[model samples]
Target: MCVLIKKYKHINTNNYNVLENALTYDIQRIENDLKKNHNSDYFLIINDEGRLGKMRKIQRINYIPSIIFLSEIELLIEDSLPKASKNSRFIQILDTISYIVYLYCLEHFNNSRWANRVRNKLNFEDVINLLDKIKNNSNIQASRTNSYGIVHYPR
Candidate 1:
């Protein structure tokens, strides 16, 4: 299973503590804590050892308080899929894909400073073309940060 462990950078604190070095120990702990309470194929470990203000981003996604939260997409599917009958999975998959696309667009637009340079000429069709370019290109994270930073485009 692919694991995405989100580790936060220490803020003002200077303590550098190493976590688990062995997979056996970690897997045992996860099994006892996660599998015992919840069913999941994969675990997303959210580490918030040092983050303070930055924790807001994580909290906003969950709408709850937690030092760490584990989510099982499959289990969530098992529970919520019935609401849409036969097409639930397809809809859910599409929604997930669309969100990824939106974030990719945001990352690209934020990086390019296209808003400032071409905002005057960018109509709805032009904006869609920008989205197409960002979606087509695979290497987006390494792109440059916008000189003017990020501005939310109004819907």
Candidate 2:
């Protein structure tokens, strides 16, 4: 006989059903308690000792999959660059990466909830404007560096 069936064989049907429900309820209650005490997020769990070992374990499990997804998006951006005059695809990818970073920040840091609020307030046009400013600054910096005859070494 199955272990569960053998263990519950002495209980009447109604009592068995009640026992099952109680067990489920107790499990959920325990989980809620743990979450409340630990300040755990969807992807991370921090214990009372303030160790992030469990969070690192969870991140390690999903790291490869996240990298693969990011690489695919990078390939899409590279392909779109040749055919589209507007770098909308690149901007979209940048926005997605920013959102992912924002989510990570929210999950990992207790005080970073403001980042989520700021990210929610930003729109596509805001992202595009930020990108334009970044490109202009980079161009100006490059010209200044060139004028100074400074060679940047790859680290």
Candidate 3:
């Protein structure tokens, strides 16, 4: 299995709009960054022979991860955050992100993979409480394509 992760070991906090500031600022900044990475009108797809053999016109929202890619995310997250006896806050945060991606795929694509066990493990609307703190009633406040999503979502 292939996994790519960027460990921000030494982040210059000033250069980034972090969690301590207004959540709105972070959400807007993330949205703007996603806009900058937009792919062209056509997207390349592989054919039955396992080769890059075709290109199809796509809508902007077609930039979403496939089941196989989400499976890879499950693999990588396991490596990064193992099943510990007691979960840490950071681990919970990462798990919330995984749940977000998993649910988004299910809701938007009307597709899901058996290999992705996140939804099975989660209770109904587990992240709902997080919304209570925010004045804006956005169900999905923010989403960023972290390494794998950045590479595979457009394919």
Which one is best on TM-score? 3
The local distance difference test score of each candidate is 0.35, 0.32, 0.31
Candidate numbers sorted by lDDT from highest down: 1, 2, 3
Put down candidate 2 lDDT per residue, 1-155, tens digits, no spaces. Answer: 00011233445555544333332332233334345554543222222222233223322122112212421111011110112214456545544544543443333332334455666886445644554444532222212333211112110
Candidate 1 Cα outliers beyond 4 Å, as residue runs: 1-52, 56-69, 72-119, 138-155
List the candidate numbers ranked by TM-score, top first: 3, 1, 2
Cα error, candidate 2, residue 55 (Å): 32
For residue 53, model 1's alpha carbon misses the true position, in angstroms, by 1.3
lDDT of 1 by residue, 1-155 (tens): 11111123324435632122122223334444445555555444332233333332332233221227654222111111113313456556544544444444444543423456445755445545645554443322222452221222121
C-alpha lDDT of candidate 1 relative to the true structure: 0.35
Query: Could you give me the TM-score of model 3 versus the true structure?
Result: 0.24
Span of 10 residues, lowest total lDDT, candidate 3: 71-80
Structure candidate 3, residue pairs in collision: none
- TM-score of candidate 2 to 2 decimals: 0.18
Give the local distance difference test score of model 3: 0.31
